[model samples]
Target: MKKETFSRVFPFALFMLFIGLEEFARFLQGKDILQVGTHAIYWIYPVKAVAVGAVLIFFRKHYREMRLGDLGRPTQTVASLLVGLGVFWLWVNMDWSFGTQGAPSGFNPNVFDDTSRTGMTAVRLAGAVLVVPVMEELFWRSFLLRYIIDGKFSRVPIGTFSWASFLATVVLFGLEHNYFLAGMMAGAAFNLLLYYTRSISQCILAHAVANLALGIYVLQTGQWRFW
Candidate 1:
């Protein structure tokens, strides 16, 4: 393998491993270590985003050499808008399946009562709207999905569709959300954005839009169950 390939793939691997370890630690502790007090959950959002962002940036040269922009090809402004709408529609229409089945059951709503919850919520919402999109799109769309098709990932034509890659990424993505089908759908939608515009940015934007919408809806409606 080329040095560039190794460099690019290494940090990507490390980021995934770091996330896995962090999440496992949180699970083992049976609490959000990043949560401040009882009702605040955003304290760790920046840490998480910065950690991953640093990894991606450290490998920035290699990532750029990999032709990341190609993945965002055939860009269409309308496609982005449509994706946003489609995601919203899915969330609205699939309430029975995604709402109940995908919703968290164990957390107390009072967790957000603490004054710290405001800062945490704002921080987390910012990460969702800003940091998460770039981090995830680079990993899922620009890297793993394409890497699954070929070790020389950049050579794996943009907009290329492969069932194996699609399903594998979706499964991994779903697993990250505790195997929820709603998470699976979210993963699938991100992939679809890649399919439509061949742009990783579009996927990121769509995801950010979806999450932002959900976050606002949850806050406005006091539906902490969805959080």
Candidate 2:
């Protein structure tokens, strides 16, 4: 892969690697081949977050689309916030039968005592809100969307649209989540946001807003499945 591709793909790949490891460990635990408790798997989230977060920071300079100046006007900021909140509302409601793959064994901090649970919940929420959005937007919108447009993805301007790229990205993004329909809806929304603003920072902000709202909702409703 080119340096550009490596810069964009590595952190997200690392994040997914950790997730795969967690799943494999869970499989072993299920079969009684691994003696570790489920809480041990929970640690993978923060570990991945930190590992990927560090990589993102290291390659921060390479992400031209994420520059501080590209945050857009006040109007665009408001639009991002509104769209984000709207997506969050739709996401929780759209957990219909066909959309769900299975009952998600989501992050449950309740397994720990009060202090550890509190810390674990905080870390999970922080990873969801802050780290995930940036990592995902970089992979999905900034890289794959353009990469599909052209192998030399950096030559393609950010938010350049083609039906093939758009449809493929939306489907792949949906498959990345348990709630496939909701994920597609969000992916489309964010794709359109990129089309409108041509700003990855706004997309990140929108994603962060949606995640923050979902995190709060999960905490309040005790809906660990959403986490």
The candidate that achieves the highest TM-score relative to the unseen native structure: 2
lDDT of candidate 2 over 1-227, digit per residue (tens): 87678988998889888988988998899899999988888988888888888999998888878966666588888889998999999999998989998777788888888998998999999999889999999999999999998998999999899999999999999988999999999999999999998899999999999999999999999989888
lDDT of 1 by residue, 104-186 (tens): 53223446557756666776577667766666667777778889999878888656899999999987776665325656777
Model 1 worst lDDT run, 10 consecutive residues:
35-44
How many clashing pairs per prediction, in order?
4, 0
lDDT of each: 0.65, 0.91
State the lDDT at 164 in candidate 2.
Answer: 95
What TM-score would every model get versus the actual structure? 0.71, 0.97
Top candidate when judged by lDDT against the true structure: 2
Q: What shift in Å separates residue 196 of candidate 1 from its native position after superposition?
A: 2.2
